[model samples]
Target chain A: MRIAVVGAGPAGVYSAQELVDAGLSVDVFDKVPAPYGLVRYGVAPDHPKTKRIALALGRTLGNPAVRFFGNVAYGLDLDLRDLLACYHAVVFAVGADDDRLLDVAGEHLWGVGSAAQLVSWYNAHPHADDSFAHTVLAAREVAVVGAGNVALDVARMLVGGPHRLAASDVPERVLDLLARSRVTDVRVIARRGPAQAKFTVPELTELGKLDDVDVVVDPADLAGADDEADSRRARANVELLRGWAERPTGRAARRVHLSFRLRPVAVVGETAVAGLRLDRLGVPSTVPAQAVVRAIGYRGAPLPGVPFDEETGTVRNLGGRVVDATGTVLPRLYVAGWIKRGPSGVIGTNKADAAETVRALLADADGFPAPLKVGPATVPALLRGRGVRFVTWPGWLRLDAYEVALGRSGGRPRVSVDDLATMLAVTRAGDL
Target chain B: MTFVVTSRCVGTKETSCMSVCPVDCIHDIGEQVVIDPVECVDCGACVDVCPVDAIVHEGEADDPSVVADAYRRFGLEAP
Candidate 1:
């Protein structure tokens, strides 16, 4: 069977690998120029080991039965109907792309940004610009709202020195800016108590290992959280946090202040973010912060012709079968990853998610339409005729070589191409 | 015009009587903001943000006993 997997993240990549292993022809497409969507651009550049997954994904794409088509967006270049007509089956694994916002006053003001935007900017996502980091680096104090692993990742990135960040694949421009950063105080504030924080134990432990960064937690913030599981985990994390808080402050470094039971009411200041007005629990007290970044969560976008739940921010699916607006199952269409389930769970979680969807596809394989054979060259020309900028396998290889060359100059494994034009130009040159 | 908050809603706290109010009479107590069921506009913003997911909207005769009990805890009179 000829299968089309939309998205080149872990979910899409793994699904394609599985299909190819089962002796099926697979074509994978992604909106980004590079594959490994979140791994390449959302994960902190310092976590080089975690990035090994991308290399594994690269190997999968190398399989003869598998083809990589980068810079292709559904609903734009190729709509759902067209995909359904071309391939025997279509699997959508497009992950959530937008960050959840706090519907409060002054949230859209200058200097206040989302954690995803900041992460994208540093990781060099094509859409991200230097404006976010420039605004954040200029501030002395910053507040990161949320208590999840991503929140901790953001907090650590802000306080981590350039030396620790040097060995990783952080973009050269971002590293230069961070090396000169004046940011000193980074407060990770959560509306819930410490025991209810969403950070895993290992992530919390990693924060304690930062030499230059101090972890601060108010004793009272742990109150009223005795019974909840999240609270219990938070208490354990706080024990480690307390140990780090007691350590002597290192010279010329930033500090991470873990604040709990604080709900941000408004972003303060006239022109830029001066401070955040927050409401503290169990007391009529409020704390002020200089910069604020909301990291509540991520939300999925609505793919044209797919049923989406606006409230939950997920594509509506029933048992891995893509559902229509009327809640009817659409044959030969499936979904996996964050789009299938709402934006939650870790990277490895997508493995199980993809496996389940693959099972459903195999069970219903006979019902799918027969695959249409269009010559490889004809496919690209057809897409081009539709005004689609489809990056061929050769183009991706060129971009890969360019990133590796760029990384060598910076003493890293790979440097990210942060714009579509640069990626297209390098690919067209056939420099790979 | 009572508004009930269920567990499925994200970020809800357990304080229920804060906004059953019809006349905008609820007052803030620390982080657990309470509503005055008497002057309430019957809007459910308070029930929505509750982290514990404990707000239940009820009609006038659904259960006055439970409503009265909640009102007493918040130091408010039931309508």
Candidate 2:
């Protein structure tokens, strides 16, 4: 069977691997010129180990039974009807791309931003805005509004010291801009208490290990917090926080202040972010921060034809099967990863999640009529007809080599090309 | 003795170790995955499966600091 998987990240690529193992021909499509959606973009550049997963994912795309169609957006390039007509089954593994808005005052201010944007900027996502570097450098004191891993990542990047990131895959321009940043004080704010924080223990602990940076936690925030009913992970987080609360504040130039039980009400500023107004202990409290970065969570983008849940920010589904508003299953339509489950869990979580979706699709395969056998030339013809300049797997390999070569000259791992024009040029050059 | 997931597993939470664990000792703790010593059978199934080669025998860890960090992260006592 010929199957089409949307979003060539961990979900889509892993799903393709599973299907290829099951003897199905798979075509993975992504809007970006490269693969590994969050791994290459959302994941912090310092985490080279996590980025290595891209190598495994790249190998999967290299499989003869699997093909990659990069720089081709599903809805924009080829609508749902076009995909349905071309393949027997389609799985939407498109992850949550946008950040959840705080829906408060002054969110649109010049200095206020989202962790997703910052992650994109540092990781060199092709579509990231240039203003991200300017915003990051302009703020001396920044307030990161959230408690998840993403929040910790932003906090760490702000204070991780440029020398520490010099060895990573961070682009040369980003490195230069960050080296000039005046940011010193980073406040990671969470609405919940210590026991209810979303940050894992390892991430929280890493904040304390940063060079010339002090992790400051309030002793009162850890007082009387009952972790009795919490999971082992939650209990461990509280333990880590308690340790941070007791540590003496040293003479570090930078500080990562972890604040809990504080609800951010608004990003208060006249022109740019001058401060963050938060509700601390049921009272009005204003934290002096030049920038506000909301890292609450990520929201999934709605597909053109797929049924989406605005309330939950997920594609309506039952065990990977896409269901309409009234709970009607749309045959041959499925979803996996962040879009199906509402953007939680780590990258490994996508493996089992995609497996489940593919399982359901395999089970339902016998019920439908045998799909018409179409050659590989059909989809490429359609893309070419629509003037969609798509990148093949070999093209991606060439672009990857170009990026690595760029970084190699600088003694870094890789220097990401973060613009479509440059990426297209690089990929096209690979076709030579 | 139990296996430990070092700094290499921080961002790459590959569960090849978890799937191979007979006792199901590997636990996802958000930032990284850890193997529970009490539950681990010392099968060494994870060492080979680690894509980044993050898994190592507790005694053979190249970096003592990374091993200690793993133990502290999982709330486990060092060997």
TM-score leader: 2
- Collision count for each candidate, in order: 25, 0
What is the per-residue lDDT of model 2 for residues A301-320, given as tens digits with 9 covering 90 to 100? 88999999999999999999
Off by over 4 Å in 2: A226-229, A370-373, A429-432, B1-79
Against the hidden reference, what TM-scores do the models get?
0.79, 0.86
Candidate 1: segments with Cα more than 4 A from true spot: A224-235, A245-253, A282-286, A371-378, A429-432, B1-79
lDDT of each: 0.74, 0.83
Native contacts present in candidate 2, fraction:
0.00
- Per-residue lDDT tens digits for candidate 1, residues A256-332, read 88887788888878877878877865454444555688899999988898888898888888867888768888888
Docking class of 1: incorrect
Predicted model with the maximum lDDT: 2
Report residue A364 deviation for candidate 2 (angstroms): 1.2
